[model samples]
Target: MEFDAVLIEPRRAAMIAAGLWLDKTADDYFDACLAAHPDALALSAIHAATGARRDLSWAELDLLADRAALGLRALGVGRGDVVTCQLPNGWEFVASYLGCSRIGAVFNPVMPIFREHELGFMLKHGESKVFLVPKTFRGFDHEAMAEGLKPGLPALRQIVVAGGAGANSFDALLSNPAFDSQRATITRDTRLGPDDVCQLIYTSGTTGEPKGVMHTANTMYANLAPFAERLHMGGEDVILMFSPMAHQTGFMYGLLLPLMLKARFVLMDSWDKALAARIIEGDGVTWTMASTPFLIDLSGAVEDLGTDPASLRIFLCAGTVIPGPVVERAQRVLGARVISAWGMTENGAVTTVLPEDPAQRAAETDGVPLPGIELQIRDREGRPVSGPGIEGGLFVRGCSNFGGYLKRPQWNNVDADGWFDTGDIARMDAAGYIRICGRSKDIIIRGAENIPVVEVEAALFKHPAVQSVAIVGYPDDRLGERACAFVVPKPGQTLSFEAMQAHLKAHNFATQYWPERLELREALPATASGKVQKFALRQLLRDEMGL
Candidate 1:
């Protein structure tokens, strides 16, 4: 796909001026901090299982990253190498990612839940030279998974495990005297341009194999500036990060943004609402970001424990839709605004509600496009759509837009004119505010009328009994496709399709939009990032409906 056709000329020019220049690479971001604040606390990693905490200063983090880079280089890792990382959220993951960037290697973050099926495909397709994983996390043996995949993945040259056996433990490499000496020789080189690939983020393949989205160092930086500006983050702010650093939201908003602003970040190995609240109340965390579910969990915990939400100033939601009620409760209970942002792995954070915006506006819309971002709604024929209240496929172009996918350079998703197709259906108001309706693939068509699944799902979520819900299209001989809902009721609550239909009907939803069939389950299948696995739910429906 070529992107030139959709590129908004003014937005492209602004992005060029604001985003980091190609001459300044990823390593330069870290180096600036080490030079300015050598003794300030840079990172604090808390082990969720063990209740252990490790702190690293600006100088210490730089040293550790350099040593890790040197150790990988000694094992023949160099420029353009793809390094697959499967460790949980912790200091090891942060250091290793920076180390790879320092040596011009592409960082590939894989979710820990991915086993042989997903892991094998990424390893082979990415042509990974080195893999950094934990020995064991939450009873899953990562070492065994790597060994199981070794036979099929011949390009894997080294397996560096963080905690388990049969591989080089990360601690030993950092402590090795030989590697320590090599760190002094490592220097930041400008040869690695901003356009060069810095990370290969694999999209959660709901359709088939995951595609490797190649993002550059400048793209990463471009994604962070608007977030920092909107939240009013500065060097004095302390951030608490519980999201995985390998994912785009975590890598950009949680980790890289803090580094860019020279702010202190507290990292947790896993998500625990109680622990996260304590970090906010006890550690003086001023800013944080996570999915909507996490915010719900945190709010519930706060209500149960009666904890005061005084320290937290900004609570941002990404990767998923933000429920209106959740946003209202967060503002009332936590005294922090719940801002929802939209983006994909291909582009970092693109659109977000500003912190100062009215709560009702933030809840109703996805907010305006961030500075340097050009957003457009286009018809199927690729003509730009004008006016308000009309939905079309969203096209985006800016400095933050990625060059292309990794390895499969020919598989471009951008148009020839430089506009990247977002695959999401959206509408632009006369004021230029963008509101996402749903994914084009996710839209349910009934008798030639498009039913916004997101709108239906959002309405269903407002029910007190509904814990989680997913709306998917089920094939129909008459209508082409009809809406089917899979619902997980809250514990001790009983719900049925009839009850949900009545509730939605009261809200003015068209009767035809009501789900024809509903499946009630104990839990909904979800990706590591907490998105509903609709494809899995579709298969479940097929078995039940006998389609």
Candidate 2:
């Protein structure tokens, strides 16, 4: 794929001039960091369930990465081959990613929760040659699972396990001294450029099957450089990351940024808010980037446990519409600036609230684009909307944007002007800040009227018993489609349809906007990134109604 066709020369030059686009790949920068501070702490991993802790210095991590790279090369995992890793957030994941980069192999990190079906599609689509997995993680035998599917995967040559007895042990790669002699040859053969594909992240299958989003080192760094600068982060800052390394939010900001800034990263493979509070106070964690659920849960935990979060500074929230009350309460309790952000697997963090921005903007809007990124909103007729507060199809163009999806060359869904439709209905304020309403496909059209899902969700979020809420559409004979509310109630609380209707009515919500049906659930179906799967809810409703 020629990135020049999508990203023109002038903008790329401007980005480089503005210091947003570094000319170096991530591996080159990692080597520089190793040379500068070999003894500095590079990563700290915490087992979320057992509370076991491990720390690695830059020197130690570099050695492990070198050995891992050599082991991969010995297994025929050469340049341009996809090295798929399905491991939790730990030192092994870090080693795998850096090792792939070292040998010019594409790092494809699959979520641990993904089973054979999802895993099969991703490995096949990525054409992964060498696959890595934990021997057993979260009670699932990953080694056995991978071995079960190995016969069907002709492209997969090896299955490397992270722990326990397995076909190949990841620890052996670290202890193997034979690779020391092959360093020169390995360096000579592992040549890679800034434009070479470094990461292949699959989108969360919210609406459908995931797409293999391909990103180069330059493209990933374009977002990370400006993000670190905007947050005023430095090596002194310690980052606590709970989002899985497979997700882009965690992959780019959580894993990649630490290497760039030479900062310390604290990884948690699971989400436990109480443990998070303890880690924050004990380790002096200053920053984190995750979805709204983490922010919401952590705020509650801090208040309940009376944890001292004075060391925590910034929280970047994404993946959903954050209710205003949740943001206000979270800031008051967590003692951190709740920064709202919006991005997808196709692009890294494109829009984010700055630390200096007003608090109201953080609660009300999703913030403006970073340098090298541009957004435009268009109507149904492909005409650009002129004024503020008018909702339209959102399109974006930027250097941080992806070049194309893997193996889907014909699916380059971009306009002639190079703007990619975000598949979102959004409105831009006069000051250029964007507020995402919802996905264009998720909107419920009831009798020629569009039900604003964000507004309804926000309003319902204020209800006392409502813990989480999602509004999905159901087929209706008269209205073509009607709104259905899926509610997860607070603990020890139960809600009824009559009570919900009265609550919305008392709050002055219109009848047309009110959900016609209410269904109580323990939890809403969500992607690993915390995005609600409305299509799954719609499917359930259809199945129940026999539509």
Number of the top lDDT candidate: 2
For all the candidates, what are their Cα RMSDs to the real structure? 10.8, 10.8
Q: Which ranges in model 2 have alpha carbons more than 4 Å from their true place?
A: 1-19, 173-181, 204-208, 441-547
Model 2 worst lDDT run, 10 consecutive residues = 1-10
Tens-digit lDDT track of model 1 for 1-547:
1212122233445556654333456577777888999998899999887778999999888878887888888778888888899988887888888888878787889877666656788888888988888898888788877877888888898888887443387876633456776665677671255667777877642333467877766676776776578778898888888877777777877778888888899999888888788778877899888767678788888888888779888887765556677788888889988887777777877888887788876667777787777898988887888678789999998767876765565555676667888888999888777788767656665533445576678789999999989989877643546788888999999788789888887765647668988888898899999998888887888888898
Candidate 1: regions farther than 4 A off: 1-23, 165-167, 174-178, 205-207, 442-547
TM-score, predicted candidate 1 vs. hidden true structure = 0.79
lDDT of 2 by residue, 103-189 (tens): 888889887876665677778777889888988888879899898888888899898888855338887653367777776665734
The lDDT per prediction is 0.76, 0.81
